[model samples]
Target: MLQIKHFSLRFSLYGKGLEQRDLEVISSLDVDIKAGELVSIIGSSGSGKSLLAHAVLGILPANAHLSGELYYQGQALTKKALEKLRGREIALIPQSVTYLDPTMKVGKQVMGVRHDAADVEAVFRRYKLPASVMDKYPFELSGGMARRILVSAAVIAGAKLIIADEPTPGLSETLAKEALAHLRELADMGCGVMLITHDITLALEVSDRISIFYSGLTLETALRRDFEDGGRSLRHPYTRALWKALPQNDFSPLPGFQPYAGTVTEQCAFFPRCTMATEECLHPIPMRDLRDGKVRCIHAA
Candidate 1:
């Protein structure tokens, strides 16, 4: 299980001349994933979904600064803890196939430190990957095969928590579903899975809960069922708009764009585009429990 509380990430960047400024990319993100549960983080590109994954894995750049806390199975995910947990108790299925080594054979990479060929072969078989794929290079494998291999690596590690960052992009619909199914299977087998993706519709089919992220903040975290019936049960305005925007729903487009990262104000990030925005929305909004879910909008009822 994993818990992220009041998590924020910022980078110290140099501006014109010697001026140094902080660019906040993630703010007040709160999410928890329990064993046998799959939580999907839905947001647009550059919403810091992938960055959250990197932060948890302790792979962020040197200039990056973090606030708040990350806990795994009731323990703080300190740098020392991360060093021990990374790729062992916790594993990442990265966004790109580029995470695979071109020089190393697929089997060797998937085997990892355990180097258990039998375990690797069994996992490969479960994904319908041929035995011959073990001897193939990363370049030689198809995109779908490569994706399954990434999942296999996590399986081989016997990780308790799996962070899958944008794992379905660049694959066919069938392959994408296949990839998601693998993650679903993992969660069913008692693994905590965090699926970071932009496709809310696709995610809804597999996620137990959905966290609606925008402009570097999570506006709402609701159960998948709340997204039903035109999202009438959804709390946040942005969340309902996203549901309506889906082709299977109203397909109605929201009027404005998400604010750029680092441009977020202390006030509600959705204030500019929210039709329901009041003068009160000009102040900071904190996430609070509502109907067994969580929403950052004060007006939500």
Candidate 2:
């Protein structure tokens, strides 16, 4: 239900004396979510996963400049359209609970005030929230409760595309599984869910597809099946490295650091740490369709 093509994001900074420079955080990224699918974006801390969410919701900072086309339900999803759909057709489960209003009662924030009490109560029941939570303030809710509140709001919206950014961090194991099940249920009901997270292992269980992000770009998009047997079924050097780094796999850590934005040359961003890098990797590597998915590596078949 959502498609992003050649999406890029940059931020302009003004140094001393108006000396300006741009930091490119997203570059030539592409992802698609079908009406009944849940796609997970997995990457390291600075991989621009959250930036993609802000760009889609049109909540970028004033200094942020975004390029490329974003589509929703086959229509161009412009900024104005997003403003109308953000809290209704397209909802966000933000990474930080700070997005919650400290002053407003929880029910008002979740149901948006105009919603019927019965509808609000039903959504609460589905998320296992007690009726008493409606009268509580944000401060009264624990971190796990706050996360569930975020999910409950989106479920009530009946959003076609739900961008859940790190929605299960503070949740208990049971509550975390419950949240994932809810998202999966939403997808089964024909809603497109974009689950952005750092937990590839857990994401594998709920997400239909996985898109690996590295240094501001998507290195590969693969099915959950491809993540098995030590990533033998996947492509992209970075992706395999990530799988190996997982405790369930080789437990080997990748060497070298992800370079700061704008410092990347036409050469592959994974070049410095990639043991398989060749001199031919000097040029910009375009994404290629291989097997059943896409990869941004030249050596991948």
Candidate 3:
């Protein structure tokens, strides 16, 4: 069980003083993830998806100023508190598995975290990793093997919550599915999991709920059934465009530019690219309750 209330993190662009122009990243973000529930965060590259992940894990760089209430199992978490929680209660499987130690053997690296050799070995075998590969360093393994190794490390850490950022980014389709299956197993075992990805198809396949982010702001969140049954109940315009772009036995282009950090303004971040934009779009958008979930948009009601 993890919750983020009015979470705000920002990067300073220039001189001191809190001005609208000084904000470079995420504004107010609210998120709630429950135990044994797999939630996926879908958004374009620079939409603060990864930033939210890092902020949750307290891994963001020093220059970034973070202010928010992050709670794990009802316990308030600060940067210092999160540092203690990492590698034990919260594990991060980064976007790149190549970041693992190249000099040490795979078994050594995994055991270094939890110091449980038997558990680490069991995880490796469960992931179908060969016994011979255990002695090899990160550089010696193939891409798929490296990905599995990262997954093994996260599992062996015995963390209560796992934040996986593009866990299957570079793998082939079959391998990607395999990696996701492993994450599904983790969720079934009662670990609160956040799968951060841009692939809606994969997210729909594995997640219990879906949260859509656009321009560093949360757009819509809904049950998996709502997304599959044509997403008719969806409110946000960005979500409508996303559902329209899905390949349905036909390939149609989804035209739009990816959102950037500094491009969006305080007033309706998606207004510039939104086709349904009206004069009301220029005003500050508020989060409207639609009974099923909350959506931030003028037209969501």
Candidate 4:
């Protein structure tokens, strides 16, 4: 339903009023979501996960410049096309509950001005939200309630593709799982779902495929099953490191830190911390197909 190829986002900042420099936030990002699949983008805080979300929804800041191709249903997705689809065919469940309007009642916001009351009530029931909660204002709702309400909004939008940014944050474990399950259900119903999250465990639970984002680059895109058995089938070293770091896995520690996004380099983004790095890694790395998935590392055989 959607494709983003060689996507990059750059911000122009002026240091001394006239001295301008470009800070590339997202580079060489490639993501594809099919009609009946849920793809999770897993990364740390500054890995440009949220930026990718904003870029897709055409909500990036005015100062930001984007390069790459975005497509929906095989046609070019331009700014005007995106505007037409923003809240209708493409919807967002933002990470912050503050995305909700404090002035509007929850039901009216979810169902829209011309939408049916029955649709709102049905979505509320799906999320286990009570009927009484519909009349409540955004400020009156609790965090968990608000998160569910966001889920309610996205599902009610009946969007062909849904971008859910960290939807499970701050929720109870049960609630988190329930929310992911709901997203999975959306994919099952033929709605492409792009789930942006930091919680790898939560992502593994519901995503059909997982894309690892690191330092504004996509390290790997592997199937959920590839994450099994210490990520043996996974191609990228970073992805394997992430899998082994999980409590249920090897539970080992990886040294070093993710480099800053502004740190310019020619080698692979993971080169500095990669144990298997050699002199060949000093060159720019290109994403290549490995096994059944894709990895950005050239050394992954």
TM-score of each: 0.98, 0.96, 0.91, 0.97
The all-Cα superposition gives candidate 3 an RMSD in Å to the true structure of 2.8
- With candidate 1 superimposed using the best TM-score fit, by how many Å does residue 6's alpha carbon deviate from the native? 0.6
Indicate which candidate wins on TM-score: 1
Instruction: Write the residue-wise lDDT of candidate 3 on 172-278 in tens digits.
Output: 99989988888888899999999999998888899998888876678788778777667677778778778778886224455767566567766687787787888
The model with the greater TM-score, 2 or 3, is 2
Q: List the residue pairs that clash in candidate 4.
A: none
lDDT of the candidates, in the order given: 0.93, 0.88, 0.81, 0.90
Q: Tell me how far candidate 4 lies from the true structure as C-alpha RMSD in angstroms.
A: 1.2
Best by lDDT: 1
Which ranking of candidates, highest TM-score first?
1, 4, 2, 3
Q: Which 10 consecutive residues of model 1 have the lowest summed lDDT?
A: 111-120
Model 4 poorest ten-residue lDDT run:
259-268
Q: How many backbone clashes does candidate 1 have?
A: 0
TM-score of candidate 3 against the unseen true structure: 0.91
Off by over 4 Å in 2: none
Clash count list over all predictions: 0, 0, 0, 0
CA lDDT, candidate 2, residue 107? 89
lDDT of 2 by residue, 1-301 (tens): 8999889899999999989998999987899999999999987788888999988888999999988999999988887898889988999989888899999989888888558778888999987889899999999998778878898898888788999998778778777787788889889989999999998878998999999988888889999989866589889988998889889788999988988656788899899999888998988998888888999998987
Q: For each candidate, C-alpha RMSD in Å? A: 0.9, 1.3, 2.8, 1.2
